[model samples]
Each structure stands twice: as C-alpha cells, then as structure tokens.
Target chain A: MKHNFGAGPCILPQEVFKQASHGVLNFNNTGLSILEISHRAPEFVAVMDEAISLVKELLNVPEGYSVLFLQGGASLQFAMTAYNLLPEDKKAVFLETGVWAKKAFAEANLIGNAEVIASSKDKNYSYIPKDYTVNADSAYFHCTSNNTIYGTQMHSFPQTPVGKVCDMSSDIFSRVINVADFDLIYAGAQKNIGPAGATVVIVKDEILGKSGRKIPSMLDYQKQIDAVSMYNTPPVFSVYTAMLNLRWLKAKGGVAEIEKENNEKAKALYAEIDRNPLFKGTAAVEDRSKMSVCFVMENPDLEKPFLKFAEEKGCVGIKGHRSVGGFRASLYNALPITSVHALVEAMQEFAEKNV
Target chain B: MKHNFGAGPCILPQEVFKQASHGVLNFNNTGLSILEISHRAPEFVAVMDEAISLVKELLNVPEGYSVLFLQGGASLQFAMTAYNLLPEDKKAVFLETGVWAKKAFAEANLIGNAEVIASSKDKNYSYIPKDYTVNADSAYFHCTSNNTIYGTQMHSFPQTPVGKVCDMSSDIFSRVINVADFDLIYAGAQKNIGPAGATVVIVKDEILGKSGRKIPSMLDYQKQIDAVSMYNTPPVFSVYTAMLNLRWLKAKGGVAEIEKENNEKAKALYAEIDRNPLFKGTAAVEDRSKMSVCFVMENPDLEKPFLKFAEEKGCVGIKGHRSVGGFRASLYNALPITSVHALVEAMQEFAEKNV
Candidate 1:
C-alpha cells in the first residue's frame, strides 16, 4: 500500500522484480545465478543481446545506432563523452539545467574546454533555459533531459548544430521520442529502467573515432561496440533485471501507451498541489518534470506534520531533497496511478485539517 | 551436476545466491526492489556499511585502510591507480606477468612514464619472473596477484622500497595475506566475490593526496572514501550480492577455511593433469595459480574434442583463453571439491581415450 517517491533507484514493476529475483537463483534454467555466469557465455550473451535489441525496438532507435549496457552510471559518461568526443583544442557546448547538467559541464571542463551555452542555475534551476545557439564546430552539445533534484525537465529538446547527447537518466523510456535526432543518449538504469549497476548508452555508429585522443578502452565507445559490451565483466544481474523491465514495458504496449498513463498520474498530483491552499508547486509550470513533482508548503511549520500525516496514510518518500526542502512525489514509470491518487487525497486531508 | 569453471563471473555459493534472490524482490520487507532503493537511504546505507565492515573484518584490514566499492571493474582501476598515485615526473614500476599486467602497463604508459622492472612474456608468461629489483624512489610498484590467462601467480608478494599495489582481480579472498605488504589492493567482484559490476579497492589512507594531479571525482580514492562510496549511485544489487557472499564466507569460516578448500581442489585437478601422459600443465609449477589451472594436450589437435568431451560430461566453461589455447579450470572459493573431482575424472577419461 505504500507509495515510493524516492528518486532514482525509485520504483519498478512488481512483475519485473519477481522475474529478476528468479534470475539470481536460476537464469534461463541454467541453475546458476545470473551473477555467476560469464558475460561471454552463450547463455549470458543471449540475455545481453536481447536486452540491447529490445531497448532499440522499445525506443525505436534508428538503424545506425548501437546500444551499449555499461557500468559506472551517468556520472562516468559525463567524463567519457567529453574525453572521447571533444576535439583536442576545441570545445563542447553544454546546457546547465540542473545537478546532472552541471556535473556534465564540470567533467567536460576538467578534461577539455566547454562553454555553457545557457544556464537556468541563476534561478536555482527551476526551469530549463531556451534560445541557446549551438556552435556547429563544437564537438557535441550535451544536456540533461530530466533533473531529478529540482523536478525540472526540458519540455522541448534543443536543436543542436553539432551532434547531440542527452543524459536521460531520469526520464528515458517514459515517452516516445525521435531517437534519430540524438547522436548519443545515455541513461542510468535505476530510474525509469531497472537498477543501479547498468547505464544504457545508444550511439550512432558513424559518430565515433573523431577524437584524436587515445581514449581508454573502458571509456571508448568503439571498443565497447567491438567487444559487444563484453570488453570486460558486466553487471550481469542488473542487465538481466533491465531486460525483464523492458519486457514488462513491451507487454504494457510500449512507451507510447506508458506515456499516457504517466501524464495522467502527474496531472492528478499536480492538480492537487494547485488546488490546495497549503502547498505550492516549486518548478516553472511548463518546465516541471512529470517524473518528479516538487512542491513546498505555504506555511513552513506544517512541513513536518504534513510529512508525518502522509507517512501515516501510507504515502512515503514524499520529503523533498535537503537542498530544496519541501515535498517531492516522484511519479516514475512504475508508480501506479492509484499511488498518485492516494497522495492527492492525503494533500486534501492535510489542507482541510490545517486550514 | 554441472561444473562451472569460467575464469570470472564464475561460480558462487548456492546459499548466497538463494538469499540474494529474496532481497531483489523485497529488500528487508520494505516492499522495494533492491534496485529501486536509493544508495543514501538508511536501508541501503546500512547494507553498504555492513558490506564494508564485513570486508574489513574478513580481510583483517588495518584501521588506516579504507575499503571502497567502485564501478568500471579492474580495467578502470588500471588507469585510476596510475592517475591517482603516479606522480607526473617519476615512473611507476610494473611487473609484466600476463595479459592483465600488460593492460595495466599500457594504461600507465598512456598516462605517465612506466618501467617494466621484470617480464615473464619472454617465455609466453608461463612462469613468474624472479630476482627483480624495485626502484627506491618509484611512485609505486604494481603486480597482478594472479594471472587469469596464463594461470600463474605471485606465490609471495613483492617487497618494494616504495608503496605497492596489487591487481588481485582473479585471486582475491582465496587466501589470507599480510595486508601490510601493500599500500593498495583492488579486485573485481565477479571472481572470488559475488558479481561483476563492483570492484573492491582497499587503500591505505596515508598514501593518498600525494599525486597533486587533478583526478576526476570517480577516480579519486579520497573522494570515494569521504563519501563512503555514495559519491555517485553505486551498483547496489551487485554490492548486496557481494555482502551475501561475504556472509556465506564468514558462516563457513573466513578466508582461512576457504583457502584450504581451494588448495585441495587445485591439487586434485593438477595431479590428474600431471599424471596423465596425454595432457601437460601450462604454467611453471612454482608460479602456478591455485585459483586457475591452465593445461593443454601434448598435441594441439586434440584440444577441440577434449573440450567437447569435457562439456558432455557436465563440465562447463573449461575452454582456455584464445591467447593460450587448451583448457583452464578456475577453482575459486565457491567451487567445491566435488566439481574439481568431476573435472579431474573427465580429464582422466579423455587422456585414456586419446592415448
């Protein structure tokens, strides 16, 4: 009955969890934990192949794109993309929307020069910036698709003159998008996909080998592609769970159908925040994330009691991030509409009791 | 009845896998996929704390040593260790034993000046080199504790005038060792531990912050130690499985007991290979790895049928590395004596048939 709103590593379908749990005991009836199997073994290779293939199909990736399941999460990709793509003395453009974008920029700056094309940081990143021009000569333009902490999202993606890479860690597979527009897209699996160990990276095959730098094998996309994501030992259990989750998504009519349900869930919760006198939404209306809804109380002292009341009513993980205090109800792909409805009801009860 | 002898992502104790399976579905009865829990949440933080604490106890790690569970496997550590510890002006000493050692040297050479003080490659790395001298002012000395491809091991660790680091990727936790001998040690979890995504790094705190070179946050040992491995989203499921495996290791008596079993298994298998006229052990007796036993036929043409025959007799993953063709039997902590007996019997039958 409890609603999970904790962001990234947040929530997953019950059926996906069940199937993944069984994989740890016996994967493909091999009588071995998926963790115990070799990544190169035909049995595990089949699992890896299907996971990558399904992601391409589910996301409707273009023909030239190759999907890679890598370790080190999105944080590592921030450095890897910059190291592998940025030309020796040139730069890359970045849109600093929130924590993730800032991190990407920071890494790019450390490895090579990078310009901040636009930034919403001046206003505490409550909205995504607009009307920024990407330099055609730059290596690639990078931006975060969804900000987990501030509950802000890029409602419309930027048109990059250069190649485009999106850190879709929080909102991947939640909606259908033109995969061909992006040169590279990377997402940590904990949020909308499956688990913490794996990060899904889809890259256009032709976009590689441009940077003259001798990129380390682990960070090099070409090396990863050549080895079939088996250049080294992979996060086997995490990858298997991701496959299970993708299967669940396919069963539920893929991303297009899931997007509708997600939109409705966000609307129900956002409507309650708007209607209630005691709470106020945090992010800009147009830029607010459908995945994570951040809101603060009109009466600051009521925050603790409101959280307590919500917890008592079986709504959990509603406390906002410490940096931006209030409440954040993360409505991810797996969060049921019933959970969003329950949160709305709790908000109504709290407003009635307080005001 | 099947024996799994794959080098890594290898066998794990059945009990560990069983317990880990349950946690994936409902971690600690919290109705959350272990994959879905935030690394900073109390539930997962507790898991991380326990895993680190258990590793400390089981390894008898000193107070000054900090244990960190990281991503990118041992491959990433090759570059990270050099970047973090190797000073700009001085060369780090490396002992080239096999494929992994060569990889470490290549990465180090790319980052800074590196010296290969000794090499076994002249003999195709069939033996570990001896009578090598360590530089007095070298940044650090690096060696692979066990060679996965050639099945050779450093029977006794090197005594260096400077700090020492060992890439114990394939042989860590198989036996007790003097922790004081090395300033840092790293191992991929897939082999002797639980799974692949997590890498265990134990560092002596005093040896850090010396390099003055700017290390990316992910590669900095101090940054990870400061955050207690929560600097970024961790491989939660993998670490949890490692904890389960560690718990199993403790329940059956720690590394000391596991070492005894490992030794016995290796001895039985090697005896069969040595006594059989048709087969020949690959590595020199003095340098042979207790974990991985590499062998091939006196005549190379019999390799294919020998592998097929072994596989048919319920022995899996016994194929040798392409670099060194023949067969490899990886006897890790979780690999029981019975499996080794099964492999030994299969080898005996194959030898009789070939003769």
Candidate 2:
C-alpha cells in the first residue's frame, strides 16, 4: 500500500475511498452514479443534510452557529469572512502566523481597515505569535489555527472580545475544540473533512450580516445559511464523499478518539525527528503541528537523499515545502499509525546510512 | 437501463462514471486516490491541464482566450461575471430569457448598473427574445444561451456591438458555437461538462482586469488566468471526471457529432409530444431546447400518473421543474439517443392508456 503524505487533499480512510468509489458508480444502489445525481433530488439532499449533521455531531457544534458546505476553498473563505463580517468603519485585527493568515488579513484589508497585530514572518513563520491582543473595537479577530506550509499551529486561540474568525483549513476536525470558542471557523475540506472542492464554515449566527458591505449572495454567509447550503448547487460528489468520510469519522468515535490517535501518530514521528542524529524539527517545538509534521536534515545536502531513501521505503510525500526543505509527513485523521511507524523507520534507517 | 434526465449535476457518460470511480480508489495506478492527490501534484496538474486543453480542442477556443476550470457553480458566476466585466460607470444590458437570466441580471445589477434590455418573462420565458439591439456604449451584453427551467434555447445570438457574455450552463457542449462571437462564456459543468463542483469559463484575455473595482482574487478572472485555474485548489474529482467526460466526447467524435445526436434526440421527443393527443409542448415551438425537453399532459390531472408511468419504465428524473409543472427530460451529451427512445416509448405507451 502506498503511504500518501501529500498535504491537504491528503489521505482519507481506505474505506471512505472504497465507499466514495462505489458512490461514483452506484450511489446507495440508486443505480445512478453520484456524479450524475441531481443536487435537488431527494437522495442527494439527504446526503447534504447528513453531511452537515455529521459535522455537527462530530464537532459538538453549538446551536447558535450555522454550518455550511461551500465552494472556492479556503482562499474564497478568506475573502468571504471579510465581506460577510468585517464592517466598513471598524478595523479587523489579525495575528498573522503564516501565508494563509496573511492572505486572510490581505483580503480583509482590501475590503476595509484590517491590520496585523502580531506576525511570525521574521522567523519565516516557524512559530505561532502568542502575544497579540485583538482590539475590542475591531470587526473581528482573524487567525489561522494551523499553518500547513510552515507546520505551526495555534495550540490555543487568543482571547478576544471582538468576533473571532479562524481559518482552520489544515488542522480542523483532527482534534476537538469547543465550538463556542470562535465566532467563525472556516476550513478547506481537503484536509481532514473529505476533499478539495468543499469548504466548511461554522459561523455564529449573530456575527453575520453585520458587515456594511454589499456582499454577493454566493459570498454572504447569511444567504448560504438561509438556503441551507443549497443557495446554488453544492459540490455534489465532494459533499457526498465528505459525508461518507464524516460517517467514517463518526464511527471511529468522532473527534476525541481521532484526536487521541492523531496525537500518537504525531508523537511517534516527532520523537524520531528529535532522536535521529541526521534530522531536526523545523517548527517551534510547542507550536509544531499535530497534523503536518515538518522537519529537516541536519545537513542540507542529505535532504534529497533522505527524501529518496524514505520514498523507497514507501514513505512518500515526505518532501517538505521548498521554504522549509527536508520533509513533512502530514499525519491527518485518516493516516494510520502504521504509516507513522513506517515513516519513523525510514528516518532511523536514513540516519544510520548517513552516519 | 436507468435513464437519468435530472437537470444538472445531471447525467454523464456511463463509462465516465466507471473511470472516475476507479480513479477515486487508485488514480492512474499512482496508489493514491484522486480525492487524496494534491492539486499541486504533477499527476493532478496534468489532469487539470488536459481538462483545459480538451475544452479548447472541443470548442475551438482561440489563442487569446484562456480556459479555466473553477468552483462555485454558475450561481457564483452570476455574481463574478458582473464583478469582473462590468465597469463602475457603464451599464451591462441583458436579454432576460428565464429564471437563470433574471438571476444573472440581478447579481450584475447588485455590482453595477445592469438592466434587462429584453425579456421573455411575459410569455413565462417560453421563448428566446429575438428583437433586441445591444447598445454600443453598454459595458457588456449578456444572454442565457439556453434556459433550463423554461426549455428554451437561443437558436441564434444577437449581433452586439459590446462585449457579449453568455451563460450556456444547460446547452454548452450540446451544440456547436462560434467561440469567437462571445467575449466570455461560463457554464456550470453539471449539465454537459462533468459534475456539480466545477464551472467552466472560456474568457477573452482582453476583456478582464478592466472593471476598475478591487475584485477579490477568487472572483477576479484575470487573477484566475494568471494562476491558470490553480489560483486555488479546484474541485479535484470534478475536474478529473470532467476531463474524462471530455475525453469521451472527443472519442465519440467531439461536439459536432454530439450535436447531431442531440438534435435527433430532441426531434423524436418533441415530435411525440406534438403527436400524442394527451400531451403538449411547453416552450415556444421554434425555440425548444435540444437538451431539456419539457412537456405536459393535456389534462393536468393525468400528470402524476404519467410521471409514475415513466419512472416505472426507468425514465427517471423526468419530472418537470415546479415552474413548468409537467415533465423535463434533459437530453445532455452523455445521454444516449437510446435513452431518449426509451423515454419516447414510455410517453407513447402512457398516451395509449390515457386514450
């Protein structure tokens, strides 16, 4: 079996793939491919409903929030969060951690007054900024919960009086979080949810429709909620397969259980990075992502060799982002502990060879 | 044996379904699911490239135009087209044909000065409005190439002085069109492309980046082209499956061949609708859609029975849109003429019983 560690649009449970594959052929034995099923049809509607429900059940989503399945990925969410929540007069505050967080701020800045209160850019986003205070008069406090590129994650969110909006695109649903902690949480479904096309937004009902800007209906959170995510035809197969993935997540005892498993996987790989003589962890130890484990070889020259060495051992997609050149093994919810073990063994073997 | 006539997120070739299903489990023998592959991966990049190439090849899109596969169905395009193309000062005129046309106008109107220059709404949008001259000074002239709800297709586009934009969501690949005639053509891929998640836009490069509004990156067509539809992660499975569907279209001798089959399918059904004493065509006779064929029983009371009768004969998704109140058998490119024959046979058998 190939160990897929390619970051977001990464691995899901094997069963989800099998189940989703079956759906593309014959969804629920309707004798119609999920690819062909009408979004308005009862069967597909049920899939959308259940997918939303699974999100609620899995996350213990609070009642005051609206859950949405939308398109255009987290990049669109960056613009939408600003359009739907940031007001004309008030400035939006951001703790810029990485590229995604910066993009989130940039979009908001384009629409209205938005400023970065804290940034880790000087250190190449190796650590999450911890000492930023969101202005009480701000429109919202925006942050990226996990930085997929740098492998840094906000272990705890900054407490803010203003609305809290977080782009949890890389690490959502990998662990449990209190749903009431943030006013808005948007995640690209490519990571932990299901696939690339659908993005999930959990927005507190009260925070939307407050932006004075005339938002497009597609970008308006309130409109999407009112239509119950059917404002337009949702990404059908993406949502359907996402439902199957969520169902699998639910069956695996939801976020808490998955979180525990995730902890073990991250722990195993990070331990090897620390213990192995040839490798070193890249992110700030405290802020290192549980989902995307980033690391580098002690000698830069050995990086390519290790990557090739690891791939030969079936530990693929371990090549790190060019910005942080070495390796990144994304231990998403579906990536098994066995894959982690395999990666750890590769690291150990590579270290011995290099020595 | 199932005849899927459901409107978009509608039917695709059965072989496309099988290939897509196989890709889901193990894409290209890469030991990675298509659902899991990174959009940045060379494998998926090739899929995206081939998809764009196939669109150009099939449609004979000119060199100056960029073909983009994007997310957020046509509804998003309703907003995006206006946001991208309509300038702050000039009015965008429209020939409103159906509900979709009205929506396209509404979204454009929200962004700037957009008005309906002509409309077929007075006749319940049963015909395409023919006698309208677009102002040379207008920002753009927009039209819906095919009105899915009312079962009307534009047999000939209006010769316009301004930039011509068309939403060909229902009838894009079903007919041959001179691509050079329109400045931009956008279609939600659900109908004739592949699935619900992706929307296709063939846009002239010169027309974009002139709106003078600070368009959001996701909504900005120029930004999308600069990034080549990889501005963000596109719907991976949708684009891949669309590529497969397009490959199938090319294999079946491309759009020219499909249009002939589409014509024959429409002819057989419309003829039966006219000949059967219990039924009547809903759209204006000359403006009938080759893709979506809507018809009603002469006795409204017999509608329910006829629907059941057709479904029993495996002519599923034939129920008409609520606005039309009859039956709509969408004969998309992938829908075989055999399925159309089966639907016609069911209609004939039902007519015999009613008599």
Candidate 3:
C-alpha cells in the first residue's frame, strides 16, 4: 500500500471511505443512490442533523454555537465571515502568518476595513507573530490555526477585544480546543476532516446579524443558521461524506485520542529531520504544526534524490508547497504512524547513501 | 419500483449512479477514493476536463463560450451574474415570468440597478410575459427559462438589445438550446444535471471583465474562467457525478434524443390531465413546462385522496410546490416515459374510483 500525505484533499480513513462509497451505491439500501436522493427527504435530513450534532459533540461546542456545512470553501469565508460580521465603520484584526492568512486579510480588506495586527512575513512566515494588540473597535480577530504552506500553527489562540474568528481549514478535529474561546470558526473540510466539497462553520449565535450590509442570502450567516444548514439544497453528497467521516472520528475516540496519535506522528518526523545529517526542519521549533511536518534537505542538491527515493518506496504526496519547495509530511488524524516511520527510514537510508 | 417526480434534487439515471458509486470506492483503480484525490491531480483534472468538454459537446457550445463548474449554486449566481455584468450606470432588464425570475431580479437590484421590463405575477405567473422591451442602456437582459415553481417555461427566448443571461436551473440539459444565442447561462446542477453541490456556468468570453465593480474573487466570472474553474477546490464529488451523468447523456444520443423523450413524457401526462374531467393543468397551454408538469384536482376535495392513492401505487414526490398547492410531475431527462405512464395510470384509476 502506498502512503499518502498530501495537504488538503488529503488522506481519509479507509473505513470512512468504504462506508461513504457504500452510501453512494445504495444509501440505507433504499435502492436509490445517494447522488439521486433529495436533500429534503427525511433520510438525508437526518444525515445533515447527525453531521451537525456530531461536530458539536466532538468539539465540545458551547450551547450557543451553531455548526454549518456551506459551499465555497474557507477562501469564500475569508470575505463571507467579514460580510456577515464586520460593519462599514469597524475594522477586523488579522494575524498574518503565511499565504492563507494574507489571502484572508486581503479578502476582508476588499469587503471593508481590516488591520494586520502583526505579521511574520519578514521571515517568510517561518514563525507565528506574537504580542499584537487587538484594536478595541475591531469587529473580530481572524487567525489561521494551521498554515498549510509554511508549516506553522498557533499553539495559543489570540483573544480579541470584540470577537474572535478562526480559519481552522487545515487543523480542525486534529486536536482538542475549547470552542467557547472563539466567537466563530470555519474550516474547509478537505484536510483533517472529509472531502473538498463542503466547508464547516461553527459560530456563536449571538455574534451574527450585527453587520449592516445587505448580505447576499447565500453568504448570510443568519440565513444559514435559521435554515439549519439546509439553505438551498446543501452539497448533499459532500455533507453525507463528511457525516461518515465524522462518525469514523467519533468511533476512534474523538479528537482527543486522534490528537495524541497526531503528536506522536509529528514527533517522529521532526526527530528524524533533526538527527539526519542531510535534513532540517523548516518552521520555528515550538510553532511547527503537528498536522503538517515540513522539512528540507540540508544540501538542496539531495532534494530530488530524496524525493525519488521516497517515491520508489511507495511514499506519495511528500512534496512540499511550491512556494516552500522542500517536503511536507502532513500528519493528519487519518495518517497512520507507520507511514511516518516509513518516510523517516527512507530519509535515513538516502542520507547513508548520499552523505 | 418507485416513481420519483421531485422538482429538484431529483432523479438521475441508474447507470450513472452505479458508475459514480464505483468511482467513489476506487477511482481509476488508484486505490485512492475520489474524495481523497487532489483537484490538481491528473485523475480529477481529467474528470473536470471531460465534464467541461461533454457539456460543450452536448450544448454545441461555440468557440467563444467557456463552461465553468462553480460552487454556491445558482442562487449565488443571482448576485454574482449581476456583480460581474451590471454597471452602476446601467440597469439589467429582467422579464419576470415566475418566482425564480422575480428572485433573480430582486438579487440583481440588491447588487445594482435592475428593472423588470414585464411581469406575469398579476396572474400568479400562469403564462410567460412576452412583448417586453430591453432598454437601450441595459447592461444585460436576464430571465429564468423554466419557472420551476409555477411550472411554466419560455417557448421562445426573448431577444434583448444588450447581452443576455438566463438562469436555466430546472430545464437545462433536458432540451437543446443554441449556445450562441445567449451571452451567459447558469444552472444549479440539482435538477437536470447531477447533485446539488455544483453549478454550471457557460459565459461568452467577450462579455466579461466589463462591469466596474470589485467582484469577490469567488463570484467573479472572469477569474473563474481564467483559472479554468479550478480557482479553488471545486465540489469534487458533485463534479464527478455530473460528469458521469453527462457521459450517460452523450452515450444515449445527447440532448436532442433526450428532448424527444422529454416531450413525449410531457405529452403523455398533459394529455391525461386534459382528458380527465377531475384534473386541470395550472400553466397556460403554450407556456407549460415540458420538464415540470403541474396539475390540480378540479373538485379540490379529491386532492388528498388522489395523493394517497398515487402514493400507494408507488408514485413518489408527486406533491407540488407549496406555493401552488397542487401536483407536479418533474420529467427530468433521466426519468423514463414509463414512469410518466405509471403516473398517468394512477391518476386515471384514482379518477374512476372517486367519480
């Protein structure tokens, strides 16, 4: 079997994939394909309900928080969240860590006003910015929990003066976090969750409907919440696959147990990068993401050779972001620790042969 | 065998469903599920490419038109189309035929200036409004070709002074239409296409990039076309299923052959509605939709019993839209004429027993 570590649209548990595939063929043995079933049907509605409730239970979400399965991914939410939350007079505070954070900031700025409280751009986003002051007049503080590109993650979420919004696109359900700490959270459900079709949004009910803009009905948070995420025939197949994946996550002891295994996998790869003579970890020591372990060849000349060696050993998707141009071993919740071991051994063997 | 006549999120061919289900489990025998594959990967890129090509081939899309598979359904396109085409100085001309047209006009009004040249709302949208003039300064003329709620359709598309945009959400692929006649066309895929997650947008390249508005990247037609609809991770499963359905459409002799069948199905049902003394059609004779055939019990008291009778006879989803409070039989391309015969038989049997 080949090992998969691609970032976002990445690997999923085999059981989840199998069950999802089975549903596609004959959901509940109704003799009707999931692709053909109406979303308004009681069967699919139950799927949506269970998916929402599972997300709440797994995250230990507060009573007032509502989870939504929406389209347009986290990139759209970069503006949609602002459209629903930020008024014309207020600015949003953003912590700029990498490419995704900058994109988020840009989209928010396009909609209205946004301020980058702090940025690590001086170092190509190798570290997380700290000690940034949240503006009192800000509508929300938006941050990316894990930088899929730079391999950095915020270990401690920043508290904002007015409200907090986090883009957990690459790291939701990978670890445990207090859902009560943030007013809103959105994640593109391709990494650490299910597929790429649906984006999951969890928000505190009290924080919505504050913006003065005439929000488009599809982008309006209040409209989605009122409709129970059934607003306009939600991405049914995507939501159903997400439900299956969430069920799989719950069966494996939820996020807490998944987090422990994730940490061990990250630790294994980072240790190899440290001990191997030809390899080096990329991100700042403490800020490195447990979900995405990035590293590079010390000589740069060995990059191609190491990649070739790893690929020959059935290790797939170890290529790093094009901007980074090294290697990123995304240790998402579904990736087996054995795959990390295989990569580590391959790296050591390549070093022994070349260096 | 149950007969599915749901308005949308409706039925698809059994062959397409089976093939889609198989792909979900093992896409191309790569041992990786379609949900797990990256959109940029050759496997899924081929999927997107084939899907676009099939749509083009089926519609006989001209060289200047580009087909894009986008998210956020046609409702988002209600604003997005206006955002991209309607300028501050010019108003969009809309021909209001039914609920969908009015909703489209309202959304365009929210974005910029949009005026309804004519409307059939005075008669509960029983017929299409002709003799509407497209203003000289109009940015574009918009219309809903098939009114899903009212069960009416445009027998002939209105010629406009400026550009033309149509939301053909319910009846897109069921019949053939000249692609060169319209500047832009969009449809939510839940109806005649595939599932609910994706929307198909076919736009004339020359018409875009003219609107003077800061369009959100997700909503910008030019940006989506430039990126070849991979601007973001698309609804992979939705696109995949649509591709399967489109493939089935082409193999079964494309839209031309399907239209003949659709017309026959509509004819059979409408003939029954006309012949039966207990039933009456809601839409005007010339404007009645071939895709959605709506009828009501003439006695009014027979509605409940007829519905129960039909349900007991394996007829599902015959309930009409709540707004109309009657029975609607949606004869999508995937639905066989035999199902329509079954529906007609059920109606005749019910009328005999009740009379």
lDDT scores in order: 0.89, 0.90, 0.89
Q: lDDT by residue for model 2 over B127-226, one digit each (tens)?
A: 9888878888999999999888899999998788898999999999888999999999999999989988999999999988888898888999988998
Window of ten residues with lowest summed lDDT in model 1 chain A: A30-39
Q: Per-prediction count of colliding residue pairs?
A: 1, 0, 0
Would you estimate the TM-scores of all the predictions?
A: 0.97, 0.99, 0.97
State the weakest 10-residue window (summed lDDT) of model 2 chain B: B346-355
Residue-level lDDT tens digits of model 3 in B1-355 = 8888887788999887777777777888987878777898998999999999999999999999999999988888998998899889989988898878888898899889989989998889989988767777789999899987788998788667788899999999989899888999999999888988999999999988888888788888888988989988988888999999999999999999999999999999999999999999999999999998888988888898889889888788888888888898889999999999999999889878877
Q: Lowest summed lDDT over 10 consecutive residues: which window, candidate 3 chain B?
A: B16-25
Segments of candidate 3 deviating more than 4 angstroms: none
| lDDT by residue (tens digit), candidate 1, A1-355 | 7788888788898888888888888888887778877888888899899999889999999899999999999989998898788888788999998888988999888888898989988888899899778877888899899987899988888777888999999999998888898999999999888889999999999989988886777889999999999888888888888888999999999999999999999998898889889999999999999998999999899999999999998888888998789999899999999999888999999888887
DockQ (0 to 1) for model 3? 0.72
Instruction: Locate the minimum summed-lDDT window of 10 residues in model 2 chain A.
Output: A346-355
lDDT of 2 by residue, A182-238 (tens): 999999999899988999999899876778888888998998999999999899988
**Candidate 1 TM-score to native:** 0.97
Q: Relative to the unseen true structure, what is the C-alpha lDDT of residue A162 in candidate 1, on a scale of 0 to 100?
A: 83
Candidate 1 regions off by >4 Å?
A: B299-302, B349-355
> Per-prediction TM-score of chain B?
0.98, 0.99, 0.99
